[model samples]
Target: MITVKNVTFRYKGNEETALNEISLTVVNHDFVGIIGTSGAGKSTLAMALNGVIPHEFAGDFYGEVLIDDEDTVDHAAEYFGRKVGEVFQDIDSQMVASVVEDEILFGLENFGIPHEEIGIRLEKVLRELGIEDLRHREIASLSGGQKQKVAIAAILALEPEILVLDEPTGELDPESSQEIFGLLKKLNEEKGITVVIVEQKIKLLCEYVKHLVVLDRGKLQFDGVPREVITHIDTFKRLGINVPPVAELSAMFRADGSYAGDVTLTVEEAEKMVREVLHDSV
Candidate 1:
């Protein structure tokens, strides 16, 4: 659904590029996770995906970013808005409406969607995101998790094919973060919404995402299946990115010549692998 080719961007008066010749493709229904330390250009890359880099921010950009086969850099902001839906880390900053339902319907109403259709979409989004209980609640009264869900419902109401979230769970507690991540996984699996999330919670992402893209110093350092990326514990550690705990434990067992099977990224998989190894040895 999106293609970035040889893309590079440099801010004004800055000597270094925020993004350096990065290239990647996001297909339909793919759950892609991007991880990097502070100033590693993860957030900049997210902005570039939706044409916010050069258009919204002053910068020199080179190369092409195509959304649904259209050149994002050449198109207007409104055009990209329809193809991409963005949820920033700060829910307060992205929210424009006071009530949850109004916020969800705000974008659709702006685009001239009929009032009747807006009502239907509002209900559908509320239910789909499991935020029905928050429908009439004031935005200011919501918890961090509820607020984030409402924010996501607002973006989902646009019905964009691609959902780009920058640390969507950054402000929530662990339970709320888990809830939000579960919804994202369901959306990707059932609705086929292509998801690109720039997150610091590596362990949560490892549980659901199909692909992992690692960035370092404004460049693509790794891109592949989740397990493959997780297996590189030393490399990830050196880059200041945390490896999944399960993957780290599996690696330790492997080094000791005790684990003979595949590396695991989840707790369930790790438990099964360890049980099998112990049973066989005994």
Candidate 2:
């Protein structure tokens, strides 16, 4: 549902491009994860997906970004905003309304979605995110995970077909982070919403995201299934991704000829593999 073609973008005064000749395609119902070191263009790529690049950032943007076969450059930010919902790493930056209900309503109001439909949408999103009780809570009173859910709820009420998240769980605890990921996964798998996330938390991400895209120095280095991508452990390090301990152990096992099956990217998978291997040895 999304296509980026040889896109190169540079800030007005910067000599180097933030994104250089990057091309990618994401189909409908795809859950794609983007990972890389700082300045690798992961966030820049996310902006491009939803027209935040040329429209909001305003750079020397070259090439094309298309959503649903429609070139993003041809439309205004509002147009693309209707098609893509974006949640950034910082919860504070995304909040406008103090109360949770108004926070969710802000986007729907801006979009001119019917007022009658607004309440329904708001209620649905809050219920779906399991934050209905927080409808009247103050944004500042909520915890990091709660704020994250509110941020997502605000965008979700807009009912956009695609969701783009940049380090969404960056400020949350481990349990909270897992909850956020679980919500996103449910939105993707059950609702068929195309989900794309740019994250540095590879260990947590590897367990949920089915597809992985790696960037290096503003270029696409790798794109494939996460389990398969983890097998190329050295490439991840070269790209500056911190390989999770589980992934590292899986790679070491493969190298020693003790585990020849597909790479494991999650703790559950690793545990199952270890148990099976030990049983066979006994």
Winner by TM-score: 1
Report every candidate's CA lDDT. Answer: 0.87, 0.88
Tens-digit lDDT track for model 1 on 1-282? 889999999988889999999999998898999999988899889988888877888878998998878898788766787578888766687789998888887889887778779888988998898778889999999998888888888888989889999998887788999998899999998998999999989998788799989999899998988888778889899998888788988999999999867779889999998897888899
Off by over 4 Å in 1: none
Q: Looking at candidate 1, what is the lDDT of residue 54?
A: 75
Where in model 2 is the C-alpha error above 4 Å?
Answer: 275-282
Mind giving the per-residue lDDT tens digits that candidate 2 earns over 1-282?
Answer: 899999999988888899999998888899999998988988889989988889988679999998988998899877888779898766688789989998888889998999899989989999999999999999999998998999999998888899999998888889998998899999999999899999888987788887899888899888888887777889888766778888788778778777777777778888988886677778
For each candidate in turn, the TM-score is 0.95, 0.95
lDDT over C-alpha atoms for residue 30 of model 1: 89
Query: In candidate 2, how many Å is residue 64 off?
Result: 0.9
Model 1 clash pairs? none
